[model samples]
Target: MATVTTDPFVGRLVDGRYEVVSKIARGGMATVYLALDRRLDREVALKVMHPHLAEGSDGAEFVSRFRREARAAAGLTHAGVVAVYDQGIDGETSYLTMEYVPGTTLRHVLQDERALAVGRTLELLEEILDALAAAHRKGLVHRDVKPENVLIDSSGHVKVADFGLARAVTEAASTATSTILGTVAYLGPELITSGRCDARTDVYAVGVMAYEMLTGRLPYTGETPLQVAFQHVNSDVPPPSDVEPWLPAELDVLVCALAARTPDDRPVDAGAALTLVRQTRAALDPAVLDRRSVPASSGTAGAVGTAGTDRKSPDSGATAVLASVAAVGAATAGASRAAVDRQAGSPAPAQPDSTPTTVLTGIGPASTAHLVTTSAQGDGVQHTLAMSRGDLAVDGPDDGTPSPRSRRRRAGWWWFVVVLFLAGAAVGASWWFLSGPGAYTAVPGNLVGATQAEAETTLRAVDLRSTVKEAYDDSFPAGTVISTDPPAGGKVRKDGAVNLLVSLGVKMLDVPTGLVGTTADSATAALEAAGFEVGDPVEDYSDNMPAGDVLAVSVPEGSSQPHSTVVQLTVSQGPAPVTVPQVVGLEKEAALKALTDLGLDPSSTDDYSETVAAGLVISQTPENGSEGHRGDKVALVVSLGPPLVEIPNTYGRNVTEAEKMLKDAGFVVEVRHPQGISPLNIVYAQSPEGGAGKTAPKGSTVVVNVF
Candidate 1:
């Protein structure tokens, strides 16, 4: 049955900017996807944490540690380290946007080749150690050092990734059990036994990786992770030479020391380990360094045949010559080995070269004959006769020697043949020195790392013609020679063309369009993906742009810049804040002036109040000290004051009539009767006379006396 799997985040935009394109890989804690930072329009790797790891109990702590450690990883500025860009939490989904390295993981390469050549292995291992050294100097330990975390780019640059992530996860683990959080095969003894790790712990893992690379097998194995952890705690690591006998003694010593059960027994850090590795590599003989261990199951013949296939051939004609030379070397090697085995009377140690042979002969299709004599083992001269198969016959009795007369007859022609051979050698030697292959000289001196002019000059001095080819090289500066077609010490004929590969510096990349107006985060991610580093963004207030949006960039969009250039981004801090006008006590005109001067729009409403004079300002909406942007409206309430009326005198009038007079004056009216007498309808007296010049608030009441 086939299993079906789908990625839910594909084609989905996160935080309204990153568009996940495709899934790259899935790990225990997160699934990494290739995403496009749509606003900046460049690709990035998006590692989204699994939902289970981002929710439920202890999730917040895990998320917090993840963010803190991610920042620490970002601080690592080494070229051999992967750069972390951003970390964010959206709802229940926690994701980290990081550098999208275009290459295969070390694990993938190991799967294909099983084992690597010693020189190549050392080169990659040194790069890994370089990254670790940078981290260690900053007081950060990777905790997890395995092939899966190592990346080899297309240009053969190695980068170590996932720095500090394993430690973060282990810190957040709920249980205090001895279980470790990384690959069990590479765990150090201290981590498995005491749950403690340090820089030396990383060195131990590297040692394990070195052993695996050299022997094509892990030093320990188990069906369960716990079982593996137990072995790391209890058992001592064996030397790689135990599995691969061809490995040199120095390599075996290095691996064994690194994989020592005690952390104190190994190198103190990656830097210490690196020094020892270089020393050991330098001490190895060239033959030992070049020897590759072939799998016993594949057999020697199969390994040799696979090496000569089309897949391993180079584009240069020199490879063809080398192939022929290798064939001749194999033949001579086989004949020598056969003689050794026959003399020793025992089978020699198995060599991957080829099966040994006592003699080599071939019969021609045409009716022709040729005789060649060569010395063989056991004090005897053997004569090789080549003829058409139809003319050849084996009529000699088995194990019987030739007659004495026959041998004498053959000896009579020996002198004639010797003279003929000497004459041919003399002629061949004359031609070789005069105009043949031997007259050609070697292309001298190392061309790599030299300036193009220097390489050209060296080539010309050696009587070789030079042709220039340009390529991008991260390590080499522009105008320097990266390599040569005939290599440094290879031979070429006089005036022969030697192609020189000149470095054009790191590849140039164009800044993507639409960087402006996007959020600063998207722009930064885009710039980083295009091989440029983003400096801290400069923040400024803009009248028209919203806060947190990009205003401009130091480098314009659509311009080309060398890889890893620093680009400064200008981001808006939103419109300038407008101060609310202090118009509560000012008159309408005065209030309007204050509001307009502050770039605020003002409007008014009217109401009557006893405490305030007419036409004076009462209060304003968006009150004093309230913040508003430019051109934002502020509403004001204006005062109309209290109403004035003439109080009517009720001395000669009835209570009801007097009350009506006072009530019509915008005042509440009241009538008073004698203490014990029945109330009368007419009023005899009132508190205030309703005449001109008396003023009161519209709701204030007046009292009247009744008779």
Candidate 2:
């Protein structure tokens, strides 16, 4: 029977800004969706927390933690970390908008290939550790560190995601009996017992992941989640070389040190782990790094795109690369016996890396199991506990059948299990061939914003062709995609065509031209004719143009530009006004030179002055300090010698009359030799001898001799 699922938010608008396009993935904390940001005209991943996580004030703690995801991921802007764009609560829906990465989770890859090449595994894990290192340095710890939290883009670039469980190192501790919120497989023992967590906790989880990647299986597992937790609290992770003989000693040491049952035994944090990993990678022989553990031909799942609807070729530019790893479960009793043989001085004494336990955890204790969606393993999880030394036991009902350890000891029974698996696959193969890989696919979601060439490449990756049509779209840049026929997310045949409309940019219009020397009104008319808006006239000085005449246009003439672009006209305000400098008390030639330098016409006129000296400026017509244009005129006054005055013929006359005569002649007079005042007050001697031609300037001082 087919199961039908309906989503209320699938087509709903989120907070009036994000338009939910399709569901991407679901996890223990939230459901991820591919959404369109209407405001930014871009796509994003919108993660909406489950309603049960945050309902209202009662869920304040949960809500706060949910919101902290944004701050935590936002603070980490490294390329290996997914970016957060926005976060808010729209009614009861708390959501976060993040950079939409077109890729698959590492868990999915592990699902298809079972294990990966050692080089590829390290290449991917390095980025994950680097991102975690950045977060750890920022005082944050990613409580959940597993394959599901790692995203690999189509280009094989790795990005760490799901900071939903991230918290400040100070706030990482939680009650052991409470939620105990983390996947059991990666949880450190301290997190299970003491409810204490720090950067070291994340480092421990990373070590488990490394072991799984190298061996294609988790380190421990149980029928019940508690059994897994029990192992985490008691056991130590073994070296990967035990299962995959090709693994190197360095990797074995790294995995063991990272997954040590004692928290103090592991690296201090992801930073320490990353340094060790880099050193190990550098020192390892190239042949070992390049060695393939499991080939892709072993039940490889083709590339899966966003929402699991679209398919991509392995070599596609935007293809999804998954990393799927099975859970740690009980090893066959035969393998366990082999391990015991090594412990008896076969491989030397058990070092710190060797312990009776395997490094792995399941979900929290049964009390908190309802909150978890994943076990210690990823999707399609299986229990294959890879142990270094211990009993291969799992708890279940007390049936007549033997214990798991007893059954596993009979390695010959594996033939029956293999026959059963082959039979089931044979029956399912018919349905898959009819309706799965041989049928339809969801149109790629990345075509709406990609370049024409890129969109075509994506289409071809899915065994489809692209048909492009040009459009005059102003919203997107030229040569970029505008829209697609049938749109994204719609189902189509595997061999169908994807029609695309590419933008030709805005409609081209002739630029504002021929505005110089024209009137402002005419310039405006010309701009309107060119399909442009005329902005306010900009005034500037132009020696050749008159006021209100256009001097230039903002845009170049005759150039093609977008229609209705605002073009400003530069209008001439005749010529800039020149300020007349003060020329008062300056020499006549200097004053004339100053006026001429200012581009003003200088004129001179004669004048007699008592205070001003001759050949020097006295005052100007337009004042010494006034505003005038370059061609305006300024008048200067040239001084002539004071009018000549004849000396009075009163040498022998009365001194009073001589003084009066001197005064009337515009001269200052003074009496001499008149100490006691003579009876007639007559002049004793006249210095000029009553000369009529002797002259002196007006206001000149004259002396009269008196008896």
Candidate 3:
């Protein structure tokens, strides 16, 4: 009943069986702890409900719901769903034990990275969808599906957790409520308006998550929870492309459709939503399509093309179309120059036309022109050009016969070419500077076998430096140079450092000897002392070695192997033959103890034997002193001693006299043919064929085979 606070109950023993190790997570209703199940020798996540909440009027009802939900979650076997192991009450506390998953939540991932690449983001999303779809098929709805509820393992596997809030759709609570119970960011509109929820509701939340991942921001924001809830009820979800224009429009539309205001407007269910995602993903790129093998459609192609067009050139008026095209072309050219500079390990190049220019050119037929300029400083060649009459002409400083329009066009084009030339020159110079230096060379000498410090001093005389990197080699002596980076005769850079790989000497160890005929434990200890690990020790019944002694150590004595290699010891359990002990004529307990002393269990059978005393062993299986191994069953026959006798002449006696006589003889009486006229009540027939039986076991069924 205690509430978990900052001072959690970690390392506390509970019920003398479980020890809490650490708090794994806490929710509004319960705290989960990673605990050691000492009795089972395994780790478990124990979710303990708050004590105060457990005592409320609805407490019993909620407890029942929690158990039911936990059982339902446990029934699921998907790898993406966390496995529930056990649930019970420890004193007054209610806890459910589950598999412990070590990982961070998707919420933590989002908080740390803000955004992930599209491929990684989609992969995680699809895994979440797969888990949800499975849950939906089982008629369980996970009321909360958000970043915090999704866990990502170190290996990049995504698992859905915390199904405690899930409700079976057929449950009365789900059909009766309209108010929301989950986080506002992921709440579906129907959950707010009508208190109704289904699989589509979860699909809507997944869509919201996808939107956030693509744009690095939530689709909706409000001042308070109520305001956000209201938005879910009234607003239409915007396409992700509206925020990040680079996102594929088909994907944006699919995500928006999932976040639709009405549940009916969204996909049919989580399964359908997953299908749409796969189909849309497949149609976007051939690689995705081939891997997923979903068919492509014309509609998908057109949607992608439209998205590209919308992002190509922002200016749209017919009069400015030509100018816009030219501007886009220049922008693309500048982007290429920047890319080239980046690849060449240089700073980005300057834009061709930092400012736009308009000009008129040609003497016969003048035309308006837009000019863009670029600058390069690498290769040192510069040229300029002018445009007129739909033709771009090279311009010269000495051409004197120039119209005003031609002169204006020539001036702008010349400026554009000069800028590009300067940018190209700069890119070239950066490439040359980065790729100039090569590895350092060693000066001619006997330096190949010199120590690292000696080599450094000699290399410094040639304007080079030396860095020693160590390695193991058999051909080179320890602490001696194995090789140099540039070799001895190669050309050396004036300021480059030579990297040396030195020898650590050949690997060698003495072969272990004399391990046979010793105990496995002793052999293992000896091997470990010699830097070897112990492998699984094999046991066999040996003819030559005594019990619990080593027969031979694997990897044989005097045979060299790697250091720390596992050496397996084969131990002897001794010979297989042994003699069984005699237990007959002894008391049953004494007989059992005698067999047990020989490492055998006495298989017992009880019988009445006139010759043997009561409670004594009459006989044993395999006879006495038979040869057998340990664990062989030894059957024993214990005696009850003597049998029951029957009453004589009871048939002719009166009823009372007969009953008393039979009772005195330890015989039970039964009247036979009571309804027949039989010599005025004198008995005529008796069982045991009338005095043929010698003795019968007491309490044995004496069926006068009943007439």
Best by lDDT: 1
Residue 3's C-alpha lDDT in candidate 3? 28
Q: Which stretches of candidate 3 lie over 4 Å from their true place?
A: 1-6, 14-16, 168-179, 286-707
**Candidate 1 regions off by >4 Å?**
1-5, 174-178, 297-707
Question: Relative to the unseen true structure, what is the C-alpha lDDT of residue 183 in candidate 1, on a scale of 0 to 100?
Answer: 88
Q: What is the C-alpha lDDT of each candidate?
A: 0.69, 0.67, 0.62
TM-score of structure candidate 3: 0.44
Clashes of each: 9, 17, 19
Which residue runs of candidate 2 sit more than 4 Å off their true CA positions?
1-5, 164-177, 295-342, 345-707
Question: Which of 1 and 2 is ahead in TM-score?
Answer: 1
Write candidate 1's Cα lDDT for 1-707 as tens digits.
Answer: 01113677788899888998888888876788888988778888888888776566777888889889998998889999988888888777888888889898889887877777777778877889889988976789999899999998889899998886778787776343334688889989898777888988998899889887776778888899888888888877765544554454456556765677777666567765665567557755555565555555553311212241221112221111000010110012222122212211111122243222222222244633333322232211122233332333233335666456645544544444456456546644654554443555555657888999888888888788899989997779999987665544444556787888999998888998899999999999988888788999999988778899999999879999877678999999987788785789898999999998887889999998888888999899999989888778999889988766566666677666777777776788766676544545666656655555656677577887665
> Compared with the true structure, what per-residue lDDT tens digits does model 2 show for residues 266-363?
65666556655765677566766766555234522221111112222222122221111211111112222222222211121111211121122222
Report clash pairs, candidate 1: 647-689, 647-690, 647-691, 648-690, 649-690, 654-683, 655-682, 655-683, 672-706
Q: Candidate 3's residue-wise lDDT over 349-449, tens digit each? A: 11222323322221223543322222242221111123343355544356557776777887886676566556545644553344321222323354678
- All predictions: root-mean-square deviation over Cα? 17.2, 23.5, 25.9
Score every model by TM-score: 0.46, 0.44, 0.44
lDDT of 1 at 15: 87
